[model samples]
Target: MKSRHIKAQITSFCFILPALTVLALLLLYPVVTSVFYSFTSKHLIKADYEFVFFKNYIAVLTDPDFWTSFLTNIKWTITSLFFQIVVGFLAALAVDRIRKGKSFFRTILIIPWAFPSIVIALSWKWILNGVSGFLPNILVKMGIVDTVPQFLSSANLAFPVLVMINVWFGAPLIMVNVLSALQTVPRDQYEAAQVDGASPLQSFLHITLPHIRIVMGLLIVLRTIWIFNSFDMIYLITGGGPAGLTQTVPIYAYNVGWGLKMLGRSSAVTVLLLIFLLMVCMLYFRILNKWEKEA
Candidate 1:
């Protein structure tokens, strides 16, 4: 009997071994290599590398450009995340209140979320092109402005425009998730609240918000990491141009590794990014635990 049980366990392990191997190759390999490379004098073109201890880290930490990109990354993540949550939550509430065509409306609204990031970035880039883009031409034709607005090139407008585009792309995901969470809420609770002379706002605050709070917290944590580490949208649309106003840490790291051939320094930047994000996630999970206990 014991031999049979051991065989069963071994078979189960064998069944999952392939998936485990792939996961390690995909996820763990890059992380381990990056960490190893960060402590060495690795170059993009050079095949030879040597241990440099903390030199790469010190160089990255002292660079003014790195700090500037870090600041922009923070602002970008916070603003984009704030709007995404607000827009998504409000949209989910509106969809929930409606009785007819719920499926159609949800489908239409989530269309943006269905597209690949590359598609979204390229489509927005064309739409916001300075010379001949649809939005600029339409605005000019309507006398909204005398000149075509350089949405991607203008320093003042570039960051905000990117934020707007991010919100549009990200909000739909939040909306779908929030909507699902909203549905999980017990209808009987709302009905009970109504019988006790509670207003809609009162019931929503006391009941609706609590039940969905955990889901929203988890969504925020995921979105925060995603937006902070975002690369493609900014890279494709603006290329972190117009006096580097829209440059984020990922872009900075890309320029360092690919442009300057400083792979070691770039790896250091990524390591720092990982550490910061992990800390942020830890704080978030702590809050989530507190909320769960209260719930």
Candidate 2:
């Protein structure tokens, strides 16, 4: 019996060994190398390097650009999260209450999420173009402005527009998650509330909200991390343009590492961002655990 159990354990390990090796090579290697590179003064094009200890970290921490990018990241994540959750929740509620053409509505709403980020960015860019874009042309015809305004090029407008675009792209994910959770809510809960003469709003608040709260909390945490580290949409849309207003941490790191060829400093930025994200994950789990306990 012991020999059979040992053989079974070895068989399980053999089955997973290839996947474990791939993960180590692809994920763990880069992370470890990046950490090592963060402490050295290395440039992308230069071969020579000197050990810098904490100098790169100090420089990154003290840099104004880093702070600006960090704050912008915070704003981007928070604003996108709020709008996505609100819009997605409303959409889910509406869809949940609908009986006819439900699948059609869901498919249509999820189209934005299915589209490639680059494609979405390019489409929005053309639509919002200062020169002969559809939206600006319409506004011009209405005499809102004599000439087209550059939505993606204006510092003040660019960030908000990027945020809105992110909200559009991300809301579908929240909608799908919330909708799935909503479906799992037992029908009897609503029926019981109805029997007790509960209003529609009351039934939703007392029955629906509690049932889906866990899913909502988890989704928010996941989306927060994704949005915080997001690079592609904003990069494709604005390229961190119009005086670097939309440069989140990842974009800033890319600019530093690739554009400026400062690999060491960029690695430091990456390390800092990783640390921040880890702290966020810890806080999120802590809060989530407490909520679970209370419930």
Candidate 3:
């Protein structure tokens, strides 16, 4: 019996070993290498390098640009997330109550998410371009401005525009998730609330909100991480431009590593980002655990 059990364990290990090896090579190796590089003064082309220990971390922490980038990331994540959730929840509620053309509305609403991010970014870029662009030309024609305003180029306008674009792209995901969660909610609860003369808003607050609370929490955590780490939308639309006003941490890391050829410092930035994300995840889980306990 012991020999048979040992053979079964060995068979399972054999089945899983190849996947484990691939995971180690692809994920673990790069993470370990990045950590090692973060402690050194490595450059892209330079052959000679020296161990700098905490120097890179110290420089990054003291740099005003890093803090600016981090703040920008926070603003982007939070603002976009708020709009996405609100819009998505409302859309889900509307869709849930409607009976006709449901599929059509769902299809149209989800197009933004289904479209490629790069394509959407480029399309918005063209529309917002100050030089002979479609939307700006129309705005000028309507006497909204004397000249076509550079929406993506202006420091004051760029971040908010990016957030709006992100909201458009991200809201569809939340809509679909919330819609699914809404479907799973027991219909009898709402019916009972209605029998008790509960108003629509009251019913939603007491019945709907509690039912979808878990889903909303999980979605917020997931979207927060995704938005915080987002790079392509900002990169394609503004290239972190107009004097780096829109540069998030990923963009900063890319600029340092590839643009400036300071690989070690870039690795350090990456490590810091990882640490920040880990902390955020931990906080989210702690909050989630607390909520579950209270429930």
TM-score of 1: 0.97
lDDT of 1 by residue, 1-295 (tens): 9999999999999999999999899889999999999999999998999999999999999999999999999999999999999999999999999999889999999998888889988898899988779999999999999999999888789999999999999999999999999999999999999999999999999999999999999999999999999998999888898789999999999999999999998999999999999999999999999999988
Clashes of each: 0, 0, 0
Q: Candidate 1's C-alpha lDDT? A: 0.95
Q: Model 2, stretches more than 4 Å misplaced?
A: 143-146
Top candidate by lDDT: 1
lDDT of each: 0.95, 0.93, 0.92
lDDT (C-alpha) at residue 143 in model 2: 100
Tens-digit per-residue lDDT, 1-295, candidate 2: 9999999999999999999999999999999999999999999999999999999999999999999999999999999999999999999989999999999999999988988989999999999989879998999999998888889998679989998998899999999999999998999989988999999999989889888888888998899999999999988998888788988999999999999999999999999999999999999999888889878
Q: Which residue window of length 10 is worst by lDDT in model 3?
A: 124-133
Kindly indicate the candidate among 1 and 3 with the higher lDDT: 1
Off by over 4 Å in 1: none
TM-score of each: 0.97, 0.96, 0.94
lDDT of 3 by residue, 262-285 (tens): 999999999999999999999999
Which residue pairs show backbone clashes in model 2? none
Better of 2 and 3 by TM-score: 2
**C-alpha lDDT of candidate 3 relative to the true structure:** 0.92
- C-alpha positional error of residue 188 in candidate 1 after TM-score superposition, expressed in Å: 1.2
